[model samples]
Target: MASVVNNVVAAVANASNDEAVCGICLDALDRKRSVTLKPCNHQFHRTCALQWAESVRPDIDRPCCLCRSSVREMVGRNGRRVVRSYPFEEEELDMKRQVLEGLLNEGDSFLISLNNTRDQIRKMLKESEIERAIAEKQRQPDEYVVDIDQEGAKLEKRKHAIDNLLEYGATITALGDAATVACAISRELEALNRSNSDLASEEEDGHYAAEQSHNEDTDSDSDSGSEEEIR
Candidate 1:
Protein backbone atom coordinates (compact mmCIF):
# COMPACT_ATOMS: atom_id res chain seq x y z
CA MET A 1 0.00 0.00 0.00
CA ALA A 2 2.88 2.38 0.80
CA SER A 3 4.58 1.60 -2.54
CA VAL A 4 1.32 2.24 -4.39
CA VAL A 5 0.94 5.60 -2.64
CA ASN A 6 4.52 6.56 -3.50
CA ASN A 7 3.95 5.72 -7.18
CA VAL A 8 0.79 7.81 -7.26
CA VAL A 9 2.60 10.79 -5.66
CA ALA A 10 5.42 10.52 -8.17
CA ALA A 11 2.97 10.48 -11.06
CA VAL A 12 1.20 13.60 -9.77
CA ALA A 13 4.53 15.36 -9.31
CA ASN A 14 5.59 14.54 -12.85
CA ALA A 15 2.32 15.81 -14.25
CA SER A 16 2.61 19.07 -12.34
CA ASN A 17 6.20 19.74 -13.41
CA ASP A 18 5.28 19.20 -17.05
CA GLU A 19 2.18 21.36 -16.93
CA ALA A 20 2.16 24.42 -19.21
CA VAL A 21 0.12 27.46 -18.29
CA CYS A 22 0.13 31.20 -18.49
CA GLY A 23 1.80 32.58 -15.41
CA ILE A 24 -0.45 35.62 -15.58
CA CYS A 25 -3.73 33.70 -15.94
CA LEU A 26 -2.60 30.84 -13.70
CA ASP A 27 -4.92 28.51 -15.59
CA ALA A 28 -2.91 25.28 -15.13
CA LEU A 29 -0.85 24.14 -12.21
CA ASP A 30 2.75 23.99 -13.36
CA ARG A 31 4.00 22.31 -10.20
CA LYS A 32 2.37 20.42 -7.41
CA ARG A 33 0.94 22.95 -4.96
CA SER A 34 2.52 25.86 -6.86
CA VAL A 35 -1.00 27.13 -6.55
CA THR A 36 -3.41 26.11 -3.86
CA LEU A 37 -6.54 24.22 -4.94
CA LYS A 38 -9.87 25.73 -4.03
CA PRO A 39 -12.57 23.47 -2.67
CA CYS A 40 -14.05 23.91 -6.14
CA ASN A 41 -10.86 22.42 -7.68
CA HIS A 42 -9.87 25.76 -9.30
CA GLN A 43 -6.16 26.43 -8.86
CA PHE A 44 -4.07 29.60 -8.53
CA HIS A 45 -0.75 30.67 -7.14
CA ARG A 46 -1.74 31.44 -3.57
CA THR A 47 -0.03 34.81 -3.38
CA CYS A 48 -0.39 35.93 -6.98
CA ALA A 49 -4.12 35.31 -7.35
CA LEU A 50 -4.95 36.66 -3.91
CA GLN A 51 -3.27 39.95 -4.69
CA TRP A 52 -4.97 40.15 -8.06
CA ALA A 53 -8.34 39.44 -6.46
CA GLU A 54 -7.78 42.08 -3.80
CA SER A 55 -6.94 44.67 -6.43
CA VAL A 56 -10.12 43.78 -8.33
CA ARG A 57 -12.36 43.55 -5.26
CA PRO A 58 -11.21 45.18 -2.07
CA ASP A 59 -14.17 43.88 -0.11
CA ILE A 60 -13.64 40.37 1.19
CA ASP A 61 -17.36 39.77 0.82
CA ARG A 62 -16.81 39.67 -2.94
CA PRO A 63 -16.32 36.38 -4.72
CA CYS A 64 -12.88 34.85 -4.08
CA CYS A 65 -11.97 33.93 -7.67
CA LEU A 66 -12.90 35.13 -11.14
CA CYS A 67 -11.94 31.99 -13.06
CA ARG A 68 -14.91 29.79 -12.23
CA SER A 69 -18.64 29.90 -13.00
CA SER A 70 -19.45 28.75 -9.48
CA VAL A 71 -17.58 31.66 -8.04
CA ARG A 72 -19.47 34.01 -10.34
CA GLU A 73 -22.74 32.52 -9.21
CA MET A 74 -21.75 32.98 -5.59
CA VAL A 75 -21.07 36.64 -6.16
CA GLY A 76 -24.36 36.96 -8.02
CA ARG A 77 -26.22 35.84 -4.90
CA ASN A 78 -25.24 39.22 -3.47
CA GLY A 79 -26.76 40.98 -6.51
CA ARG A 80 -23.42 41.67 -8.14
CA ARG A 81 -22.11 39.86 -11.15
CA VAL A 82 -18.47 38.78 -10.71
CA VAL A 83 -17.57 40.12 -14.16
CA ARG A 84 -18.93 43.55 -13.31
CA SER A 85 -17.04 43.65 -10.02
CA TYR A 86 -13.76 42.70 -11.66
CA PRO A 87 -13.50 45.00 -14.59
CA PHE A 88 -9.81 44.62 -15.34
CA GLU A 89 -9.38 44.26 -19.07
CA GLU A 90 -6.56 44.41 -21.60
CA GLU A 91 -7.55 47.94 -22.59
CA GLU A 92 -7.34 49.06 -18.97
CA LEU A 93 -3.79 47.76 -18.72
CA ASP A 94 -2.87 49.63 -21.86
CA MET A 95 -4.37 52.77 -20.42
CA LYS A 96 -2.34 52.38 -17.28
CA ARG A 97 0.83 51.98 -19.32
CA GLN A 98 0.09 55.12 -21.24
CA VAL A 99 -0.57 57.04 -18.06
CA LEU A 100 2.73 55.92 -16.62
CA GLU A 101 4.58 57.03 -19.70
CA GLY A 102 2.95 60.43 -19.53
CA LEU A 103 3.96 60.81 -15.91
CA LEU A 104 7.54 59.86 -16.67
CA ASN A 105 7.76 62.46 -19.41
CA GLU A 106 6.33 65.11 -17.11
CA GLY A 107 8.88 64.26 -14.44
CA ASP A 108 11.78 64.59 -16.82
CA SER A 109 10.54 67.91 -18.08
CA PHE A 110 10.19 69.29 -14.58
CA LEU A 111 13.64 68.11 -13.58
CA ILE A 112 15.16 69.84 -16.55
CA SER A 113 13.30 73.03 -15.76
CA LEU A 114 14.51 72.95 -12.16
CA ASN A 115 18.09 72.43 -13.23
CA ASN A 116 17.94 75.50 -15.45
CA THR A 117 16.46 77.56 -12.68
CA ARG A 118 19.10 76.36 -10.25
CA ASP A 119 21.85 77.44 -12.62
CA GLN A 120 20.41 80.93 -12.80
CA ILE A 121 20.13 81.09 -9.04
CA ARG A 122 23.77 80.06 -8.69
CA LYS A 123 24.88 82.79 -11.06
CA MET A 124 22.94 85.40 -9.04
CA LEU A 125 24.39 84.13 -5.79
CA LYS A 126 27.89 84.37 -7.18
CA GLU A 127 27.33 87.99 -8.23
CA SER A 128 26.00 88.82 -4.77
CA GLU A 129 28.99 87.21 -3.15
CA ILE A 130 31.32 89.22 -5.35
CA GLU A 131 29.56 92.46 -4.46
CA ARG A 132 29.79 91.71 -0.78
CA ALA A 133 33.51 91.06 -1.12
CA ILE A 134 34.08 94.36 -2.97
CA ALA A 135 32.06 96.30 -0.35
CA GLU A 136 34.24 94.89 2.37
CA LYS A 137 37.36 95.83 0.41
CA GLN A 138 36.18 99.47 0.05
CA ARG A 139 35.52 99.78 3.80
CA GLN A 140 39.19 99.02 4.39
CA PRO A 141 41.03 102.36 4.94
CA ASP A 142 43.58 101.69 2.17
CA GLU A 143 45.50 104.18 0.04
CA TYR A 144 43.12 103.23 -2.78
CA VAL A 145 40.33 105.06 -0.86
CA VAL A 146 42.30 108.35 -1.22
CA ASP A 147 42.20 108.09 -4.99
CA ILE A 148 40.13 110.90 -6.55
CA ASP A 149 37.77 108.50 -8.33
CA GLN A 150 37.38 106.12 -5.31
CA GLU A 151 34.06 107.69 -4.21
CA GLY A 152 32.55 107.32 -7.69
CA ALA A 153 33.84 103.75 -7.88
CA LYS A 154 32.19 102.95 -4.55
CA LEU A 155 28.86 104.48 -5.74
CA GLU A 156 29.01 102.42 -8.93
CA LYS A 157 29.58 99.24 -6.95
CA ARG A 158 26.62 100.06 -4.65
CA LYS A 159 24.29 100.66 -7.63
CA HIS A 160 25.38 97.43 -9.22
CA ALA A 161 24.58 95.49 -6.02
CA ILE A 162 21.11 97.11 -5.83
CA ASP A 163 20.37 96.17 -9.44
CA ASN A 164 21.57 92.62 -8.79
CA LEU A 165 19.29 92.35 -5.73
CA LEU A 166 16.27 93.07 -7.97
CA GLU A 167 17.45 90.46 -10.43
CA TYR A 168 17.88 88.01 -7.54
CA GLY A 169 14.28 88.55 -6.52
CA ALA A 170 13.12 87.64 -10.03
CA THR A 171 15.33 84.56 -10.01
CA ILE A 172 13.90 83.50 -6.68
CA THR A 173 10.41 83.58 -8.14
CA ALA A 174 11.53 81.39 -11.02
CA LEU A 175 13.14 78.99 -8.56
CA GLY A 176 9.90 78.71 -6.63
CA ASP A 177 8.03 77.77 -9.77
CA ALA A 178 10.64 75.15 -10.59
CA ALA A 179 10.46 73.74 -7.07
CA THR A 180 6.71 73.33 -7.31
CA VAL A 181 7.03 71.52 -10.62
CA ALA A 182 9.71 69.25 -9.20
CA CYS A 183 7.48 68.28 -6.29
CA ALA A 184 4.65 67.35 -8.63
CA ILE A 185 7.04 65.31 -10.76
CA SER A 186 8.37 63.51 -7.72
CA ARG A 187 4.89 62.40 -6.73
CA GLU A 188 4.16 61.11 -10.22
CA LEU A 189 7.40 59.12 -10.35
CA GLU A 190 6.66 57.64 -6.94
CA ALA A 191 3.26 56.44 -8.10
CA LEU A 192 4.75 54.89 -11.22
CA ASN A 193 7.37 53.11 -9.15
CA ARG A 194 4.67 51.65 -6.94
CA SER A 195 2.69 50.40 -9.92
CA ASN A 196 5.81 48.88 -11.44
CA SER A 197 6.65 47.12 -8.21
CA ASP A 198 3.12 45.78 -7.83
CA LEU A 199 3.15 44.45 -11.40
CA ALA A 200 6.57 42.92 -10.82
CA SER A 201 5.40 40.92 -7.81
CA GLU A 202 2.64 39.28 -9.80
CA GLU A 203 4.96 36.75 -11.46
CA GLU A 204 8.44 36.27 -12.88
CA ASP A 205 7.25 37.17 -16.33
CA GLY A 206 4.79 39.83 -15.25
CA HIS A 207 7.09 42.78 -16.13
CA TYR A 208 7.93 41.38 -19.54
CA ALA A 209 4.33 40.44 -20.27
CA ALA A 210 3.22 43.94 -19.35
CA GLU A 211 5.89 45.50 -21.57
CA GLN A 212 7.30 47.38 -18.60
CA SER A 213 10.87 47.19 -19.90
CA HIS A 214 9.91 48.78 -23.15
CA ASN A 215 8.10 51.55 -21.37
CA GLU A 216 11.08 52.11 -19.11
CA ASP A 217 13.38 52.48 -22.10
CA THR A 218 11.09 55.06 -23.59
CA ASP A 219 10.97 56.92 -20.30
CA SER A 220 14.75 56.83 -20.09
CA ASP A 221 15.03 58.36 -23.52
CA SER A 222 12.67 61.11 -22.53
CA ASP A 223 14.65 61.77 -19.38
CA SER A 224 17.89 61.88 -21.35
CA GLY A 225 16.43 64.39 -23.70
CA SER A 226 15.49 66.57 -20.76
CA GLU A 227 19.01 66.30 -19.43
CA GLU A 228 20.31 67.42 -22.80
CA GLU A 229 18.05 70.41 -22.65
CA ILE A 230 19.50 71.30 -19.25
CA ARG A 231 23.04 71.04 -20.61
Candidate 2:
Protein backbone atom coordinates (compact mmCIF):
# COMPACT_ATOMS: atom_id res chain seq x y z
CA MET A 1 0.00 0.00 0.00
CA ALA A 2 1.03 3.59 -0.46
CA SER A 3 2.28 5.77 2.36
CA VAL A 4 -1.01 6.49 4.10
CA VAL A 5 0.10 9.59 5.99
CA ASN A 6 1.70 11.30 3.03
CA ASN A 7 -1.34 10.83 0.87
CA VAL A 8 -3.67 12.19 3.57
CA VAL A 9 -1.35 15.13 4.14
CA ALA A 10 -1.26 15.94 0.43
CA ALA A 11 -5.03 15.74 0.20
CA VAL A 12 -5.35 18.03 3.21
CA ALA A 13 -2.94 20.58 1.78
CA ASN A 14 -4.81 20.63 -1.51
CA ALA A 15 -8.42 20.30 -0.34
CA SER A 16 -11.07 23.04 -0.33
CA ASN A 17 -14.06 23.51 1.95
CA ASP A 18 -16.94 21.02 1.90
CA GLU A 19 -20.25 20.74 3.75
CA ALA A 20 -19.26 17.49 5.49
CA VAL A 21 -18.22 17.16 9.08
CA CYS A 22 -15.12 15.22 10.14
CA GLY A 23 -16.07 12.13 12.12
CA ILE A 24 -12.70 11.77 13.80
CA CYS A 25 -12.23 15.21 15.37
CA LEU A 26 -15.91 16.14 15.20
CA ASP A 27 -14.93 19.32 13.38
CA ALA A 28 -16.61 20.85 10.36
CA LEU A 29 -14.82 19.72 7.25
CA ASP A 30 -15.42 23.19 5.82
CA ARG A 31 -13.45 24.73 8.66
CA LYS A 32 -10.31 22.60 8.48
CA ARG A 33 -7.98 20.83 6.12
CA SER A 34 -9.98 17.75 5.13
CA VAL A 35 -9.92 14.55 3.07
CA THR A 36 -12.60 12.17 1.88
CA LEU A 37 -11.35 8.61 1.64
CA LYS A 38 -11.99 6.87 -1.63
CA PRO A 39 -14.61 4.14 -1.99
CA CYS A 40 -15.70 4.70 1.61
CA ASN A 41 -16.13 8.45 1.04
CA HIS A 42 -15.85 9.12 4.74
CA GLN A 43 -14.61 12.65 5.37
CA PHE A 44 -12.32 13.66 8.22
CA HIS A 45 -10.20 16.56 9.27
CA ARG A 46 -6.64 15.83 8.18
CA THR A 47 -5.24 16.33 11.66
CA CYS A 48 -7.91 14.15 13.16
CA ALA A 49 -7.22 11.44 10.60
CA LEU A 50 -3.56 11.59 11.47
CA GLN A 51 -4.31 11.29 15.15
CA TRP A 52 -6.55 8.29 14.58
CA ALA A 53 -3.99 6.63 12.37
CA GLU A 54 -1.32 7.17 15.02
CA SER A 55 -3.49 5.54 17.64
CA VAL A 56 -3.85 2.37 15.52
CA ARG A 57 -1.41 -0.44 16.08
CA PRO A 58 1.20 -0.86 13.37
CA ASP A 59 0.64 -4.63 13.02
CA ILE A 60 -2.80 -4.27 11.46
CA ASP A 61 -4.55 -2.40 8.70
CA ARG A 62 -5.43 1.19 9.46
CA PRO A 63 -9.14 1.50 8.99
CA CYS A 64 -11.33 4.55 8.54
CA CYS A 65 -12.28 5.93 11.91
CA LEU A 66 -15.93 6.10 10.93
CA CYS A 67 -16.67 3.07 8.70
CA ARG A 68 -13.73 0.81 9.53
CA SER A 69 -12.80 0.34 5.89
CA SER A 70 -9.17 -0.52 5.36
CA VAL A 71 -7.50 2.71 4.31
CA ARG A 72 -5.67 1.43 1.28
CA GLU A 73 -6.68 3.82 -1.48
CA MET A 74 -7.66 7.45 -1.64
CA VAL A 75 -8.32 10.05 -4.33
CA GLY A 76 -8.86 13.78 -4.21
CA ARG A 77 -11.84 15.73 -5.48
CA ASN A 78 -9.81 17.02 -8.41
CA GLY A 79 -9.57 13.41 -9.68
CA ARG A 80 -5.97 13.35 -8.66
CA ARG A 81 -4.74 10.04 -7.23
CA VAL A 82 -3.70 10.80 -3.74
CA VAL A 83 -2.76 7.19 -2.92
CA ARG A 84 -3.26 4.04 -4.98
CA SER A 85 -1.72 0.62 -4.43
CA TYR A 86 -1.49 -2.28 -6.83
CA PRO A 87 -0.80 -5.99 -6.54
CA PHE A 88 2.85 -6.82 -6.97
CA GLU A 89 4.63 -9.60 -8.81
CA GLU A 90 6.48 -12.13 -6.68
CA GLU A 91 9.78 -10.39 -7.21
CA GLU A 92 8.25 -7.01 -6.59
CA LEU A 93 6.54 -8.37 -3.52
CA ASP A 94 9.83 -9.48 -2.09
CA MET A 95 11.30 -6.08 -2.73
CA LYS A 96 8.33 -4.32 -1.19
CA ARG A 97 8.55 -6.56 1.86
CA GLN A 98 12.14 -5.56 2.41
CA VAL A 99 11.46 -1.88 1.85
CA LEU A 100 8.53 -1.88 4.21
CA GLU A 101 10.62 -3.53 6.91
CA GLY A 102 13.12 -0.73 6.71
CA LEU A 103 10.35 1.85 6.65
CA LEU A 104 8.75 0.44 9.79
CA ASN A 105 12.03 0.51 11.62
CA GLU A 106 12.69 4.09 10.60
CA GLY A 107 9.19 5.11 11.48
CA ASP A 108 9.57 3.64 14.94
CA SER A 109 12.77 5.59 15.47
CA PHE A 110 11.15 8.80 14.30
CA LEU A 111 8.19 8.26 16.63
CA ILE A 112 10.52 7.76 19.58
CA SER A 113 12.16 11.05 18.76
CA LEU A 114 8.80 12.73 18.50
CA ASN A 115 7.76 11.37 21.90
CA ASN A 116 10.97 12.69 23.48
CA THR A 117 10.40 16.10 21.94
CA ARG A 118 6.83 16.16 23.20
CA ASP A 119 7.89 15.20 26.70
CA GLN A 120 10.48 17.98 26.74
CA ILE A 121 7.93 20.48 25.56
CA ARG A 122 5.48 19.47 28.30
CA LYS A 123 8.20 19.70 30.92
CA MET A 124 9.08 23.22 29.81
CA LEU A 125 5.46 24.25 29.79
CA LYS A 126 4.92 23.00 33.32
CA GLU A 127 8.07 24.74 34.56
CA SER A 128 7.03 28.00 32.92
CA GLU A 129 3.55 27.85 34.46
CA ILE A 130 5.07 27.32 37.90
CA GLU A 131 7.39 30.30 37.43
CA ARG A 132 4.49 32.43 36.22
CA ALA A 133 2.48 31.49 39.33
CA ILE A 134 5.38 32.52 41.56
CA ALA A 135 5.77 35.80 39.70
CA GLU A 136 2.03 36.55 40.10
CA LYS A 137 2.21 35.94 43.88
CA GLN A 138 5.00 38.53 44.30
CA ARG A 139 4.61 42.34 44.11
CA GLN A 140 3.75 43.58 40.63
CA PRO A 141 7.22 44.99 39.92
CA ASP A 142 8.12 46.09 36.36
CA GLU A 143 10.79 43.35 36.00
CA TYR A 144 8.41 40.71 37.38
CA VAL A 145 5.76 41.82 34.91
CA VAL A 146 8.24 41.43 32.05
CA ASP A 147 9.28 38.02 33.37
CA ILE A 148 5.66 36.88 33.52
CA ASP A 149 5.00 38.01 29.96
CA GLN A 150 8.16 36.30 28.72
CA GLU A 151 7.24 33.10 30.58
CA GLY A 152 3.79 33.21 29.04
CA ALA A 153 5.32 33.54 25.62
CA LYS A 154 7.59 30.57 26.29
CA LEU A 155 4.66 28.50 27.48
CA GLU A 156 2.75 29.31 24.33
CA LYS A 157 5.71 28.33 22.19
CA ARG A 158 6.17 25.07 24.08
CA LYS A 159 2.50 24.18 23.70
CA HIS A 160 2.71 24.88 19.99
CA ALA A 161 5.77 22.71 19.72
CA ILE A 162 3.98 19.87 21.48
CA ASP A 163 1.04 20.13 19.13
CA ASN A 164 3.29 20.09 16.11
CA LEU A 165 5.14 17.06 17.41
CA LEU A 166 1.86 15.27 17.98
CA GLU A 167 1.02 15.80 14.33
CA TYR A 168 4.39 14.44 13.32
CA GLY A 169 3.80 11.36 15.47
CA ALA A 170 0.56 10.74 13.68
CA THR A 171 2.28 10.91 10.33
CA ILE A 172 4.91 8.46 11.43
CA THR A 173 2.32 6.05 12.78
CA ALA A 174 0.41 6.09 9.50
CA LEU A 175 3.57 5.30 7.59
CA GLY A 176 4.25 2.39 9.92
CA ASP A 177 0.75 1.04 9.37
CA ALA A 178 1.12 1.18 5.61
CA ALA A 179 4.40 -0.65 5.77
CA THR A 180 2.95 -3.31 8.04
CA VAL A 181 0.10 -4.07 5.68
CA ALA A 182 2.34 -4.22 2.64
CA CYS A 183 4.66 -6.59 4.41
CA ALA A 184 1.86 -8.86 5.54
CA ILE A 185 0.45 -9.09 2.02
CA SER A 186 3.84 -9.88 0.61
CA ARG A 187 4.30 -12.73 3.06
CA GLU A 188 0.85 -14.14 2.36
CA LEU A 189 1.43 -14.17 -1.39
CA GLU A 190 4.74 -15.90 -0.92
CA ALA A 191 3.15 -18.56 1.25
CA LEU A 192 0.41 -19.18 -1.28
CA ASN A 193 2.95 -19.62 -4.04
CA ARG A 194 4.83 -22.13 -1.99
CA SER A 195 1.67 -24.09 -1.27
CA ASN A 196 0.83 -24.25 -4.96
CA SER A 197 4.29 -25.47 -5.78
CA ASP A 198 4.02 -28.24 -3.19
CA LEU A 199 0.72 -29.43 -4.57
CA ALA A 200 2.09 -29.56 -8.10
CA SER A 201 5.10 -31.55 -6.97
CA GLU A 202 2.91 -34.09 -5.19
CA GLU A 203 0.70 -34.56 -8.26
CA GLU A 204 3.73 -35.11 -10.46
CA ASP A 205 5.09 -37.76 -8.08
CA GLY A 206 1.76 -39.59 -8.03
CA HIS A 207 1.67 -39.76 -11.82
CA TYR A 208 5.20 -41.09 -11.97
CA ALA A 209 4.38 -43.85 -9.46
CA ALA A 210 1.33 -44.95 -11.48
CA GLU A 211 3.39 -45.14 -14.67
CA GLN A 212 6.05 -47.31 -13.01
CA SER A 213 3.42 -49.70 -11.61
CA HIS A 214 1.79 -50.07 -15.02
CA ASN A 215 5.10 -50.89 -16.68
CA GLU A 216 5.91 -53.56 -14.06
CA ASP A 217 2.51 -55.21 -14.53
CA THR A 218 2.96 -55.30 -18.32
CA ASP A 219 6.34 -57.06 -17.98
CA SER A 220 4.93 -59.68 -15.59
CA ASP A 221 2.09 -60.52 -17.99
CA SER A 222 4.49 -60.95 -20.92
CA ASP A 223 6.69 -63.35 -18.92
CA SER A 224 3.66 -65.47 -17.92
CA GLY A 225 2.49 -65.71 -21.54
CA SER A 226 5.97 -66.84 -22.73
CA GLU A 227 6.15 -69.59 -20.01
CA GLU A 228 2.66 -70.86 -20.89
CA GLU A 229 3.48 -70.94 -24.62
CA ILE A 230 6.82 -72.80 -23.95
CA ARG A 231 5.00 -75.45 -21.77
Which candidate gets the maximum TM-score versus the true structure? 2
Candidate 1: stretches off by over 4 Å: 1-28, 31-33, 64-231
lDDT of 2 by residue, 159-202 (tens): 56446444533433443346554455355446545645656677
Off by over 4 Å in 2: 1-18, 76-231
Worst 10 residues of 1 by lDDT: 76-85
lDDT of 1 by residue, 70-122 (tens): 33221211232222121223343343443334334653443344345445444
lDDT of each: 0.39, 0.49
Error of 1 at 231 (Å): 80
Each model's number of backbone clashes?
0, 0
Output the lDDT of residue 213, model 2: 32
Worst 10 residues of 2 by lDDT: 205-214
